[model samples]
Target: MATLSILNHDRKIFDKKYIYPVLSRRAGGLSLGINLNTNNACNWQCIYCEIPNLTRGKPESIDTKLLKEELFFWLHEITQNNFLSNHAPPDTLLKDIAFSGNGEPTAAKEFEEVINIVITAINEFKLNNLITIRLITNGSYMSDQSVQNAWSLINQTPKEVWFKIDSVDNDDIKMINQINPSLNATKKNIESCLDVSPTIIQTCVIKINGELPSKKSIDQYISFLKNYEKKLKGIHLYSLARPTEQKITTKIERLTEKELQSVADKISVLNLPISTYI
Candidate 1:
């Protein structure tokens, strides 16, 4: 319930003041966020996405120089102003600069160049020690060679990745992410990521139309995770953290803490490191 409380600034639509504070249960500190979709664009129109007026991804290449400059300026300004609340952890505990917004970041044509630019800026500013790079993706673009090449470049940095694996069953995947993802292909991509860098799977634990996933459906997910438990660093399970834009949106609801814990209980049976936030 506490996660639902929007910061005063966050309540206003089209809020362009980037890099705001969110109580990231998994990141566990002041997360320096990088919202690539300042224009409200995304490749996948996920049902759970809270961003309104979503478009079919960005059409042109992102300006790497401008992106780096903007990110550096914001980070420097925020650090100087201490914009976070007093209750927040010290500066050293401030977490990574996350790549998350309205859409998939790897879709940006200059993804590799942008990542390099960001890394250079971090080092130039002498703030690399406290800063980490985090990539949040839906795994839809992993099979693309250019995307993979960009991911390889990002993997060279001190970073961790969070891949969305909302469901192992194809039907459920279509319903949740609104994209028909190939489970086998996605698993292979995830395994490749684990080979190069620290990677984790993030799943949304929610009830659809006031109905929980059947046992068979849950088992399918658990079985998929079980196969990759050896390579995965951990699992970040969270419920609906914000509202959505879809006809079936209101029918979806956040799972209770108990319900989430129960899912974790089942997941632990596979001998994997799992973290639950509801």
Candidate 2:
């Protein structure tokens, strides 16, 4: 009776501690998700985040043994025990194993161990060419050597890190992502991730107050991306699909289809593959 919903990204839908499944719009089908941050904590408090009661912090200590057991169990269910047929829509393909919890997954101390577990699953299921291993991150700790080393372990399988880059203006960044981030540091992280993994730029665009992204902001965003046009895998531009639960001062609103298309038209000048989800 556990029907998966693409719009309802509630990680706790199945009562699982570390593993869950969702019909992901981005992944295009059943995305087996690994929720490392069960505590609803994150480094950046994005105003558009759908997670309720989100706090600012790193992930707590991971129970790797339990996590491994859950991962293997879910893999078995999907591959052999008819999980998709029973829990998700009929003929749902197992698209990817995404490390996309409520918080920044790279903050977990056992991130490398989890990657090792994924390697084992890949070999066990013989899914080398069938599915992808995705790390949906905010790109904060991508420069860490340990993180890079862990993520680089699975070379043969299809992999992608959907790094979030909402905006380039610091004021816009602060308003949307709630972080006084250093663009230089972000650049370094981007470089490190590119060196280790095939990366896609995941940007969530929302109307602030009552206006769409200004032309100046769009220009700055395009300018920053011009440097990575060759190195990046692609860009994902999407407006909010779910309502925000975070209590913030700014009045956030989902961009209309026209508004989103308008933004995409401006970014299309970069000539990179862009997919927009409303």
Candidate 3:
């Protein structure tokens, strides 16, 4: 049996241009992560973000060639060597190649080109059918033409998109995400994502200063889910698993398993699939 821990998702193992390996609980095994935002920047600053020293900005220019090389090298190592069997816990396997890192991946200026490079690498490695591809995003850049084009490419593969929709209330959004994106705009972007590929709503529910989300807030979230329950794949309801880098860390608290189940129960009323990680 593999004896490696899957809970720690540190992004600096290789510290290369784009590729990093993680034992993802959600992915259920080793996941190759692509980090285009090497600058440690993102448009939104979610209070619960685990990235240390995160800044508000788009990624600096991406070196697609370097990214491709790094990806192919890692893929070869993981598959040909005893990478997983030696580094991960027993029974671990390659789960997915995920576009997730310190920031919003779609915010990279060369996102479309980046996707192409990733696809080429995946095909070269001949692991396209052996693994899943995933995009973990804030769903804020779906309106951009380049981002949409990238999504079009992703639609051609066996992939899943984990879109973040933490709260429906703009006030709560500001409090949590530190940005005031209109609720309508966010909904429209999410709908756009659903049009391009399969999407799962990923929500992180946590207590603020020891208080759970208000009933009104939960109702609004449920209502939003009801609107697209038919097209949605499911909901990933999880709590804070890592320490935050934000100054508000003291104000944040992880919800217990019981509390996460409560939230999941409410969303389950929509008759959509729900998964919890606490």
Best-performing candidate as measured by lDDT:
2
List candidate 2 stretches off by more than 4 Å.
none
| lDDT of candidate model 3 versus the reference | 0.86
- Give the distance in Å from residue 198's predicted Cα in candidate 3 to where it truly belongs: 0.2
Error of 1 at 77 (Å): 2.0
Full ranking by lDDT? 2, 3, 1
| TM-score of every model versus the real structure | 0.86, 0.98, 0.96
Shift of residue 100 alpha carbon in model 2, Å: 0.2
- Candidate scoring better on TM-score of 1 and 2: 2
Worst 10-residue lDDT window, candidate 2: 1-10
- Give candidate 3 misplaced runs (Cα > 4 Å): 1-4
Give the Å error, residue 256, model 3. Answer: 0.6
Candidate 1: 10-residue stretch with minimal lDDT? 1-10
* Candidate 3's TM-score: 0.96
Model 2 clash pairs are none
lDDT of 1 by residue, 51-149 (tens): 777777673556556666667765665576544544343543556778776677777776777677767767776666676788888766666777667
